[model samples]
Target: MAKKRKVVDAKRDKNGNITDVLLEGNKNFTSTEKALGMTKSGLIDLVVVKRKDKEHLRTRPDGKKGNNLDEMADD
Candidate 1:
């Protein structure tokens, strides 16, 4: 059986170009492609990289502490 596709509520600006999209899927790609209106199988054709989106994933300002520890002077 095929997976159910969710009804995506896409957001657009005054120019009518799609800007933001909301869908139900993985924290990875399915939701992203759906929001971008790509075929479900299309996302699998290419590599989907999962990078840390500090702005979206960061819950606190010090989330980068571990990464910056070496570069930043200890206080």
Candidate 2:
């Protein structure tokens, strides 16, 4: 059997905050959050989307569905 190696997907900022995260490969922010039992505001930072990217990485809250950031920004 081949041994699987652990991957370091994210690195913390100098302030100890999660500066960046990798959605590809072995780890991601949300996965790490759930694993560490991190709830509330701490999780917000993990939820991110690239404005110029065509795909919406996350879904909007109830009643806010079908609206993109630009559409929502107008309100």
Candidate 3:
């Protein structure tokens, strides 16, 4: 059997962009923070990455490729 995909209820803005998402059931806040590698204050730097085949590419704050285009980082 194929694995089921989890669905989330999203809140969008007037432009049809996702602003927030909610998952089902009650989850522990501490556990969620720990799982996301976030502190209690929820302060972290995020990097948006795109995938090209098996390689993951990093994007800059402006959503463009940086000076080095050879997969800077990965999870």
Candidate 4:
């Protein structure tokens, strides 16, 4: 099986929300749609959630809170 990808870094806006995430050694920011697609394909080690008619990306049920996208911005 192929290795799963991870968002090692991220770019945030003024509100501190993640706008784009860095995939390992990627130079360009990954789009949300692309990330969602990857999540569906199981390429990325994250979860996809649909809420309020929109799709949101989040980490799996891991014990580490910092691994979550929201906290990844801070770290």
Find the candidate with the highest lDDT and give its number.
4
- Candidate 4, run of 10 with poorest lDDT: 66-75
Q: Which stretches of candidate 2 lie over 4 Å from their true place?
A: 1-8, 25-75
Residues 1-75, candidate 2: write the lDDT tens digits. Answer: 223222224445456444333333434453434423222223322233446743122323446533432332231
Q: Which sequence of candidate numbers ranks them by TM-score, best first?
A: 4, 1, 3, 2
The TM-score measured for candidate 3 stands at 0.27
lDDT, model 1: 0.33
Return the TM-score for each candidate structure. 0.29, 0.23, 0.27, 0.81
Q: Is candidate 2 or candidate 4 better by lDDT?
A: 4
Clashes per prediction? 0, 0, 0, 0
* Best candidate, TM-score: 4
What do the candidate models score in CA lDDT, each in turn? Answer: 0.33, 0.35, 0.29, 0.81
Query: How much RMSD separates candidate 3 from the native structure?
Result: 14.5
Once superposed on the true structure, which residue ranges of model 1 sit more than 4 Å away at CA? 1-4, 25-75
Error of 3 at 67 (Å): 36
Query: Between candidates 1 and 2, which one is better according to TM-score?
Result: 1
